[model samples]
Target chain A: MDATPQMTCQTAREAFPEFLDFRTAPTARMAERSHLAVCPDCQREFATLTRIATALDEAPSALPSGRMRQRFYAMLEEEKHSARSIHLAAEREHHARGLSLWRRLGLPLAGCALLAAGFVGGTRFSARSPESQDHSDPEARRQLADLQQRVNAMGQLVGYSLIQQRHSPTVDRLQGVLTSASRENPPPQVINELISALALDPSAHVRLSALDGLAAHLEQEVVRAGVLACLAREENPLVQVSMIDLLATARDASARPAIEKLSTNVTTDRNVRDAARRALAQL
Target chain B: MLAVRDGELNALGELFERHHGRLYGFLLKLTGDRSTAEDLTQTVFQRMLKYRHTYRDQGNFAAWMYHLARRCTADHVRRSSAAPRPIDPADLNLHADDAPHAAGQASVHDDHRLLYAALALLDRDDREVLLLSRFQELSFAEIAGILECSVGAAKVRAHRALRELRDAFFRLQRPTPPVS
Candidate 1:
């Protein structure tokens, strides 16, 4: 950091940043300042550099608009909420699956125990009431059904919310649809959400997955009609082919027009047209 | 940032609020486009979150953030290399109409505008080195870390960039002879 009598202009210029910003130690700054005092060329160079730095410091730049901030926070919130919901859904699914197994076996066992107790009591009391036993048993079954319904409703809500997210990654949206569709008895509303995704999702892969989801629920007349309609409007050949396959698998007569249209359209991919023709034959 | 690494997402928001203005300014100077600057600023924070685990407690956060910023800009350049254009001062969003102070702030002498124009002509790496040192006000050590080079090399690069900038300024100052 020492300044020598022979300090060249090149060496002096090296400290431009430190000198410009006063980052140099006091002793070094003094020596550099003295060198600039003596060297005219280096002094002029330093002046121009100062002006440039000053102008740069004052250079105008735009602040991010409120819309940008809103977009960022919206994205962040979606990520946070999605992460929490996914975690909760995984836990709930695990617990509910376990509970469902228990209900399958436990309900019968409990019923047998209650009947056995009723038969034993009947022997002791000649006027034991049959209506009392039937009443409590049906109530217990109804309670289990209610709990199951509530769990399904929660899954449907989470799935619907996730599918509706505008900025979510394709994989995440597809995952939500798949998770809901994988349930043994998904609600009709959940099926409708998947159908919407199948018809409207920007990503072909997402649409194809949505078609896969709706394929399993084709027994529902609404789901069948939705998938058939999606096939006619689907722009992606892969998704269109998949939709045709789904309809063909369901033996849906409503899909015949869509399949015939694709079959006759020369602009369609050769594979897609052939698939559609095959689907029409199946229907 | 440490809290963010430990799964406290709200901490990330605090960091964003504190650093976003400077981050956006740096990006605007680098890309010379407001929209790109905004996009890169968001990408920088998103990267901070995604790679938060890699952050060392003893590391300089500013250098780390700029490293990500450099990468983001590099990616953007690569994606749009086919249509590179010179940055126009007019493209700079000075908010002159909205803020009275901005009118004076955005106005610079002819030489200063020439300096900026020359700056745009330098190599991308040279522009980056100079901007990181001068505008960002980072020490050579921090600049070296962001550039992944030695401190001496960073200083040398900055000096060369300054030298080129001065030469460009002088070249721009030369008046063309009256067109015959």
Candidate 2:
């Protein structure tokens, strides 16, 4: 239509989308441009549209803070966990439906035979000394313990993944995971997750819970360094104070440099600075 | 997003990290409220989970997501009793703290403020059209799909919206007639 004089102001305006944005073909833009070149009203209108579009593109958009990310991840993790449980329940029902009654009965019968064999073996072994029992071998006990720890570590990893979800993890759920981590001979990975929570979890209380759970492990070099780094970067005064106290109680002299920095940091809260000073003296 | 649909929840976190900033920016501009935008960002992800089953594998995920975002804005408007108030100067000056090192920037900042004020005065539908077309940069077909209209109709609405926005902008800039 470059040759046609029939392109009306109305038609030009109707093609405003194509005119305002270059979403149209070059030929369409040529026609629109030719029309605008001859038409003042359409040209003025296009100029106004261009002005507004340019201003908006240059306008600064306010970004949501870390809190929003924390909340979204928490919600996602909860939903996933709920969905997984539902799937698991469905699978259990399917298994029940597929199993024959004879097969179901055979499982319990096998369990009884295993229990009876274990009882007979125990009696025969104990008739000699307890040390003579093959089941009492240190290697066997250690292997069983290692297996149990691995199983527990696997479970904790799942929990850790849920907590790691940047969306808002529930404080109680994290606390539950922390409590499990605090039990006898906690896995190293579980400890690592706790250290990470201390350093980076958005919620102050969650960080504090991590501190409480990890208190027993502070003697470990990595745990000490993580807590110190957390103290250095923590904006929350309460968490900082708690970290200081944990470090002092652990008698970690390595934390002295971080404590000195925080103590002398004029930007830090008065209470936090004072706490850091106290920690420095104690350490 | 495919991973999210397939029950890999952690994958959603990656998606959010990649997109939440832009998504939040869109919502912030639309609602003109930071907190509300944040709440709606969270709501969008929650809805993604709630409606994951409906996600068609072959569909455009961006289109589906923006459609959800559009619905979220509409739902929020419906739930609120009050109309969207004019954009606050303080809110519009989101980048005021940025040290404007150049002489030309002050005028640009003023222009930005004027445009936002003008945008706030437009009808919600008009603003939606302009935002989707300009800021969010959606194609007319995608806008049509989100708005539930034909492509021609979407174009018309966009044209009308742009006209109204231009009118409002000039009206704001047209200095108050010297007080009698």
Candidate 3:
């Protein structure tokens, strides 16, 4: 018990070897424990180390202050707002870039995107011409460049006509209206719009045409969600199969509940249900 | 999962209010920094949000949260403390807490401070196992789940961590750290 300071440090060094093998060495353990029975130095060291370890566990920590929490949350909100603004600005810039090419032909595609407005409770409204809205007006360029300032005012998103108009380009213009439409187009919506246009077109051939264009974009989660929603309700088995096939491309686990429900529906064709199950497994 | 997916801010705020204290205390102990622990705690919740869909049930929520927290903590420790050239004296900083063994330094109060400083020297993993087992009141199975090890391995780990901790205490000039 009366070991020199150097002697105790040496004994502690020897004891550490047991700790090195502490996970597996049975003999090292016995030796260390036996040494602890007579050596007060080792015991003291052991006590101090564990006490800090435990006290740390028990020590109380304050939750972030309300101000800090607000600051963090506000910062997140700011990020989201900036993200949205940037998205909108990009879409505008895309349209603007596309229109710049069209405006070279002196056509009014800028007015066409703005022509989406339906006024006075479901009635169509267009005033005079862009030239009168005044073509000479300095604001005319601002109006043409105003995509960035604009917001999506269509609450229900039923303006599929503008989309149909936007996409159906005439071969007379071989350069075609590149319509920054390709630029900031939300890839998911572009797919769904194509699918909807294909399904509802007067000519079933165009519906098939729409499918070819949409098929390339089908391999993503957000796009698949729209396809699945349409498929679950589609009476046409052929369209249902196409939607089911598209679901195979989505990695979304959120589709499980819907897929599970579809699995049990007896009225659905056996072939379609089997496909849904197989696709469900992939997700 | 409901608190996360439903975007229920109140629900998430309550969850943060309930769990943040323990997570901060545990991470601070593991990393030994207030700011890093704070940032890591926030990162854990952000991760919880990112992978919310994988959550099946809330039955073992605490264990699951700790599972993610401990994994991230281990990664942090690994990045912060890398293995250097062969076991030099500096590598044995963990074992050197028992020094400055002057006589009569082992008072009831010294016993308190000595254990505190000694713990800072133990490897982060051993410190984690000891803290979770003894203070968090997690069972060996839960500890295994949190530590991502088997129950048998967790018991062995606990024993080993406790022994190393005991040795570290002796090196600190304290007689014996009181057992829980």
Candidate 4:
């Protein structure tokens, strides 16, 4: 009953590796023939392997049905559309996040600039006597301060402009307030007007609240020519500041003189005039 | 015909025309129920289109299909809810045609019925491996993917299934003793 009696005829398991692949290795084929010649047990195993390979070779391939094909194609198209919609939604969310971050950091600087603009743009403020101006209604000034604070935190002013456009704020009302005081000059009105409208506005610079809107208007040729013809003779430092901003991007032949006047140390303070001179040269 | 792969309905219809009768015959032998086997074979190809991406060119395509058939057969046993199921036979046939010269076997109607019953008694896993290898003759490696097991495991399971078949055959041949 000992199974050891059958061990002598047991085939080497080595034929297995070759049998895994249907292709017979030459050595395996020779080995298989030799093993089968002497070993009945191995012959059965070999025969079984061969039988399996042949049967599988005879087995049929799977084929899909008509209705199922239609469903799959529809699903793939739907997936592609969904992917694009998801991508666009994600892009807008990212842009919104950047605007939010700017508002978080720009508020304090905006407050200081609001004060600086009201006083006027230069060191000439320190030289002024305290009694020179009339006491004004503080309400409008306060509103301006608050807006300046909001704009400061807004990061890049370009995005704030986009926000303003989205909100549809009253540019005409703001221009009206500046125009009423234009004969004398309103420092904050002029600069804010130039920032919001003249520089980037569709209107002419000559149409600005003051000659200072000239610099912003210069970004466009019609505005540039209007600003030069109307404000090139104005000596106001506030007006000159806009001129500098205008010259910053100007290639015009007429913008050179205003730029040079701002640069001369004799007319402007050393630093302001020095910066203006460099800007003029660059232009 | 629906092609679940890429919605190629025409291709699937063509494939069905080429393969249905041949596959139906094989399944008929495998299940011993002409109608059930035909339905199951149709469903298998429909499901094939569903999982066409799983097919790889590395092995014989037919072997892959048989691996699927093995799974489907095992599933049919496990569910046991398939309506119109064929009645159990006293024995089952493993092969529908002539046996190898070594066995000098001739398959007749009696042998075929016994073969079917003997096959039904096998555990689903062992039954699949045996049918795929011994009946369908798929290589062990292709069977491994369908079963998600190693090739060595497939071989051992196949060998075990064969031994079970041999035992079942022996049992059917024994005469039961009469009660006192």
Candidate 5:
């Protein structure tokens, strides 16, 4: 009796596809080869299948034009450039926050301490003679103005710190920040912080607050540019609608092209398309 | 690829250089239009960058790439208003132009043309399995992963597609019967 199992013609024909695989086991390949030697039909079918496989392997691959490579590299360069800019901006914002902390809290606290000491001394001196305490003194007016300025600085610092707090739940912190920022004549640092939040914050609600906080400052070129950039990358429909509305409200003609593209984009949300059309009309 | 996932953006350029030709070939076979293949090739790489973080260290990059390529092709098909253009046999460049002229050369060229025409006649899924298995030289396991099927199923599909292609080739080769 033969030690190896003999492959039948049907089996050999079925195994022809597996034989096309270079990885087929040698034992199985030998069995199929033995069958093919004796079986003319299997041989013919196997030969045709082998030829087909070879032709597939030898099929000439089409090469993409040079423009494809150029376009890919260009896109990669744009991504790298945008990533670098975001990284640099985050770093600058980090440094600015550190400096602003000292300037807002450190300097104001120091001035407050000095004013307290001066006030205690003045009180002690006036206690020594009530008649010498003059309300009309220019020195007293100067100290009052200085105290008021420091107190205002301290208030702005507290508001900015609330906006920067990462520990608080995003919604709560953003709400606090927005409330503080909505005050009349918010400081420039507050506006900058709001713009940073609008651009970098992950939460849509937080971004909306930041956008609202920035509403009063949209006249500033930096704020308008920041909002426009946010619109370009903004994916969330609600955020996109809000951004389009804000841009249109500002009458920013520069955003017309982006808005027009959004209006015509078939992939954009239906509501967003409608909003974009309305905004385009306004623009 | 791990480096690309870890923010080394330039590492992707190396990957692109290495795989772009084969990737373009696969897309060309799938799309049958050079310009569409070129556009989809760029789209696949763009998606690789966009979805790099999803790449697993243990996963095959080629398989992942074909996964993306399949998606890009599908998206392109879905977005386009027209059906895919059938592949022209001439575009395959299968003729042995450089070979010394011989009696068998013309028959070989005709066979090549018939084979490509048969390939174009196959169902899209059959053509894709054939392309991935034979043209790309991917293993059954890799094809299984890309096609989201079992390895056995991938092998079966490839075999069936090959048989159909062979039948079509012979059908094209047969002389027309005289009209009664």
Candidate 6:
């Protein structure tokens, strides 16, 4: 006699779902199987349930359109871009606050230092020996001029150091620097800094401001080269459009080939492509 | 998903690629409208990105995703002016592209049609349980997590739903008596 108890039809039917599952224990499945073999009613019910499960399992999943993938990637890109922009904006705000504190305190301290330097220098020159102080002594006059130049250089160094301390300068700071640097016949070093920012700043706002700062110097070879290189690598459509417009405004015909390539590239943003085409025509 | 939560958002694309097909299918069966299903599928992923910080590392990603999918479906139903109704058989799109090519091909196709119609006729809760259990192939514990029920309850619900589906399928399979 079998040691295992026989499963009643009610018990076997109740466990049909488990019985159909391959994960069910062999002994339990065998008990259900023995019941089904003896009871035709349960057998038919089990067969019908089995068929239903198979039909559902074999059902083909509908294929979504290719447009869905395109939409998904576009959304992901937008999210990533927004996340980066938010992070950069926060950094910019922090840097701006730090600079505001510096302006509140550092400017007055710098002014005081300049006045102290002038007072000390004047007192020392007056206290010098009569021969050295003689107004007709050419060597003495040259020394005084050297002293004045050194004091001026020291003031400029203080300002430059303050600007250099910020690792990630905000748009406001960059704009302020560019504004001060935009003097008549701006220094060569200033021009180089502006060009570098235009070429590499991650923020489009900063790059656009840098481009504007370089506008007056577009006639220079280095400035033109930097803008052209920026055009080649720019991925943001807004920045690309602005750079194209700047090149067009400058009438830099040498940029025609790069603009032409951008106009023809399929992956370029539509607005950027249109702007590039317009720039090429202008060139 | 942890990668997503930790700000390596690109990891989400990998998750989407791995699961979107089954998810879309699950929604398609749930809504019975392709366009609605597609829209809801997109919404589900968007919610995942939005609420990724809420996901626990030890939890199953599929369960988390289906939980979101269920909320999206519910929201969609509430937004519509009309109450939910049985899906039209035509909208079910029960084409059996994978059915084996043999002398029984027609019979298999007929069976698919009948099963889908029965699925369409099932109550919303019943249909959901069947889709989660049989189609998505999710374990009962995971279904419980998504449905906010106990594992035993999930199993009981699935068994009841399957029985109803079987009865509906056979009812449809029986030929009608000719009018006198």
Q: Compute DockQ for each candidate against the true complex.
A: 0.34, 0.33, 0.07, 0.02, 0.35, 0.25
Q: Which residue segments of model 3 deviate by more than 4 Å?
A: A1-68, A75-283, B78-112, B174-180
Q: By the TM-score metric, which is better: model 2 or model 3?
A: 2
lDDT string for model 2 (A1-283, tens) is 2324678777766776786675666676676668878788877777878877777776776757779878987887788789889999999867764563334345445655665676567567565775645667886577557755655654565555545643433654475456645566667777777888878777777788888888877668888888887887889989888989999998988889888998898999999999988887887
For model 1, name the residue pairs that clash. Answer: none
Docking category for candidate 5? acceptable
**What lDDT tens digits, residue by residue, belong to model 3 across residues B1-180?**
575555443455567667876776566556656566677777776666666667667447777677778877767767776321111111122213434345653453355454545557777778778767664445667888777789877767776676676676668674557899
Model 4 TM-score, all chains together: 0.38
Give per-model TM-scores: 0.56, 0.57, 0.41, 0.38, 0.64, 0.58
Give the least accurate 10-residue stretch of model 3 chain B, judged by summed lDDT.
Answer: B84-93
**On residues A1-283, what C-alpha lDDT tens digit does candidate 4 reach at each position?**
1223333333344444345454445666454446556676766665655543443333222233344445544544554466568788899878875764454335535655675686464225533744423235375456556755644433234323332332222453344324432322223433444444433433343234433433434455655665555444444555555556555667677777766765664857565576576666677
The window of 10 residues in a row where model 2 chain B has the poorest summed lDDT is B90-99
**What residue pairs are clashing in model 6?**
none
lDDT at residue A282 of model 5 (Cα atoms): 92
Best-fitting candidate, scored by lDDT: 5
Q: Is candidate 4 or candidate 6 better by DockQ?
A: 6
- What digit string (tens of lDDT, one per residue) describes model 5 on residues A174-228? 8656766667777778887887777777788888888888887888988888899
Off by over 4 Å in 2: A1-4, A94-283, B88-101
lDDT of 4 by residue, B8-108 (tens): 43455566555655565556546656656656675667566667767655766566666666667667756775433222332222243333343523443
B126-168 per-residue lDDT for model 2 (tens digits):
8887788884457888888889999888888987887787788
Candidate 6 structure quality by residue, lDDT tens digits, A1-283? 2223666777777777776665667776677677777787888888988888877878656777777878888888999999999999999889987986687347747776877788688768777767776867898688678876665544444433333334545744464445534554655766766766777666677677778878888889888888999888888899889889989988998899999999999999999999998888888
* lDDT (Cα) of model 2: 0.75
Q: Mind giving the per-residue lDDT tens digits that candidate 1 earns over A1-283?
A: 2246667777777777777665667677565677877788887888988876776666555577777788778767876787689889999978886775465445545655665576557545533655534535776457456755755665566566667663566766787777777777777778878888988888887787777777777788998898877777887777777878888999988778778988999999998999998987888
Model 5 chain A: which ten-residue window has the lowest total lDDT?
Answer: A1-10
Of the candidates shown, which would achieve the greatest TM-score relative to the real structure?
5
CA lDDT, every model vs. true structure:
0.75, 0.75, 0.56, 0.52, 0.80, 0.77
Off by over 4 Å in 5: A1-14, A28-41, A123-283, B81-83, B89-105
In model 3, state the lDDT of residue B109: 37
